[model samples]
Target: MDTVITVTGEQSANDLGVTLPHEHLIIDASIWVPDGPELTAIQRRKLEESVSMENLWWLAAYGRQPKWNSLDNRRLDDVETAKREAMRFVAEGGETLVDVTPMSPGLGRDPGALKRIANHTGLNVVAGTGHYVRHAHPPRIDDQSASEIADEMVGDIVDGIDGTGVRAGVIGEIGATNGFSDHPNEKTVFRAAAIAQQRTGAPITIHPPVHYKEGHDVLDVLEEAGANLTNVILGHLDGAMELDNASAYYDSLAERGVSLEFDTFGRIGYIASEDVCFPLDETRIRELRRLFDKGYGDQLLVSHDICKKNQLTKYAGHGYDYILRDIVPRLRRREFSETEITSLLVDNPARALTIEE
Candidate 1:
């Protein structure tokens, strides 16, 4: 049987149950959250406010404003907090979670922390390898060739990350922005991730910029690098619902043999920077039903993509179990059969994470 690498160790791929293909437990993606304009004294204080029931709505409601979307809100650094939140999913029948936080100092991918979470919660935690978007990448990246980057990532996959002996099961949540026009470094990372994926046969999951029809653009780069499409997953497809001819766009993407992850399950709001508004969960469910009807059900995956502190139940947001505790019932009410749901939450993730030997 093919094995899937987790933070603790390797496991039989078939043993990975009800997996969330996209999530972040111990991450600091604050680098991705852009700095806001000059802040007033009072505004700065509000931005630094600890997430609470009184301010949770304000945090979510002002998501469009970078100042209001505080850097403090974007980070999940507390191991115990992550464990407590993740255990909620374990109680709700989740067996595995893929923490696709990109491997970089700026993003702070902590393999040791992941190991602790797995040990504590008994949640098989699969980590990723690769750099994020240009902003998060170190300055040395500009001097490094794609081959050198691939060498580092392949080492992480085959040997381990930062000498932790915790091999990465996935190659991404590799980041890109506005289809690589703004950040050429993303192209290099894409090529490097593709090379690493080809070397290890590990699945590559992409974090495409919100609302860009870069699905094929991204695949083209990977294909040029001889990456296997069967082992690729493009994340945040829920953000594509607003595109013109969205269903047909999905049909073309499905034909390429790459899985599409409709993550961002619980987030609903506007993003001013991208001018993209996250659709309601009902809209995502409706789009999912449409995709299923078009026979693309097998190509689908789902997750809450919980990375922010406000997203934790401790802050009055939907916790890690949102999909199981809420979305599953909603899907059932929408007439989605158990088999389809199982494929989304279980079989697809197992297959996606399995190393090709």
Candidate 2:
């Protein structure tokens, strides 16, 4: 029998309703900051940089603005506020949310925190395990062998994270930069995550680097490590998933049975390129349509990768309910049937997150 694990406990896959495939309950992606913390406002002023191609990619891809003090808004560590967000999601009909927080300073996913949110909001929150992007990795990561890393994550699945008794339900949102863009120790984590997946039957999710691409290289690595592509999902397909460049990557992923996640919905300020704006509400639907047209609907999933405080309703974002509230209605307008929406919201997630035997 198929089962979906949550922080609260195991539940029938049938009960996993309105699932958000990738999101962060409480996190801080400070590793994403350019030049690290050393490049502060004072240093920035001395550098006298206006806007360069280096900084544009951040706005173009991750939705980070050009404000002088934008870095301060990078955290969402408040548990009480997170509880309120989860409650709002539940009230708006959100049932299950995959918290893809990896291990990081002031960031990453903690199963214990997830459990607290699950208990308070009554929403089924699936917890994450495994290391994050290269920049956020622990000092021990460079020293840990692939098998060693796999063992740690296997412990997370079999036992629990931090002895809190909250077993992780998924293996990643494992960090990769730009389709395996060599983040110092990225390949090690990728291989270990693959081993852990085969060891534990937990699904894996990938968080690509800022500069997105075909993601074929990283997928190749995972496949080489014996990962089941169907049990794996390639997330943040927004800017990098363009067909014009490689054109064959999407079909390749679909043909290989890997799922594509258009999870960052409702973030409209960012632009993809001169031709398109990323996190653009309409572009998501358009891209989603392209996927469906290509017969990859069954392998598709969607969510809002809401990791910033500004994205919350208290801070005036669409909140956790934006997808079902706004995006789905737009899909309906675009001639997507109830069946299609159900596949995106309900069926695909159950398949994506289920602990396969």
Candidate 3:
């Protein structure tokens, strides 16, 4: 049987134009580090991994300790604010924005909040289901079996989250840390996510474990789950997009009919600070061209992955807006055809999100 699955009473993929397959409008701030100093040394160490320990120690000692209060007024759950921000995107020639926030305790998992935001914004908003990384999942989940987690995930898609009667439109941002290749938690989450996909036919989007190995591991989980690989998306591919490694990863996933996502288009500063150096110039166009030349154009999706509030200002001059204002024109300048560009920003995302007419 053909593996492509469709959403109920939704528009066809063609209707989703210039869509951003991965993004965040309103994300709960608690996921980064809950507001508390009671955490042990290990907890402090783990949370500070993204930042330099020297910088953190400096802040802890001489500088004011970084508090979560900076994030207090950044809620996107309000319909009016969401509408304004989303309007900025659509006015800039963007169409759909997939709100890939997962439900976790202390994190705002309000499906009603999403619905209200979408309704007010007039943006085609896609919501997601599934747990985040092991650290983000609720303590209660440890008491449940994989089957139980799968059942809950399926219910969230088919029914509604927390019995609120609001259905999630997609199945992930399912968190796997360190990429799928090495994490045991990734395997468990993959099993549950796979079971959920099999039952609901909701397309899966991976929050790939940190590096390339995780991407490979995610594919392993999907295949094991009897998922149609084409219905799966390997997210954060750009994070590992060294020329040789990216080509191989894209080729492998494309051959399996899975889509590859380079959704961190506007995160240059944050991503640059990481150990790995991401090529921020024409490297994006070069990568796209290489994928097109390799005949994988139809399976590529692009976006900014703007999770933090600061990224919005970071976007004002050079963020998500950069994709529309800068990158598209650059691709055109490089002689990329409109069809290829469309497939990357629109067609592929619609297919992965499984929006049906």
Name the candidate that leads on lDDT.
1
| Candidate numbers, best TM-score first, in rank order | 1, 2, 3
Q: Could you give the candidate ranking by lDDT, starting with the highest?
A: 1, 2, 3
Q: Write the per-residue lDDT of candidate 2 for residues 1-357, one digit (tens) a residue.
A: 798778888888888999998988878765554544656676455234333344443433444533332443466778998999888889878999999886544575667778888988888899888888776788898798999999989998888887888888889888886546555489989999999999989999988653456477778889999999889998877655443553365667678888888877876654323344354678678778888988989999898899876677876577888998888889999999999999999999999999988
**Whole-model lDDT, candidate 3?**
0.67
- Model 2 scores a C-alpha lDDT of 0.78
> By how many angstroms RMSD does model 1 differ from the true structure?
1.6
**Model 1, stretches more than 4 Å misplaced?**
36-43
Deviation of model 3 at 119, angstroms? 1.6
lDDT of model 2, residue 235? 89
lDDT winner between candidates 2 and 3: 2
lDDT of 3 by residue, 110-212 (tens): 6776767666656667778888887787877756766788888888777777877777777788888763455565577778888888887788888875444
The lDDT of model 1 is: 0.87
The candidate scoring highest on TM-score is: 1
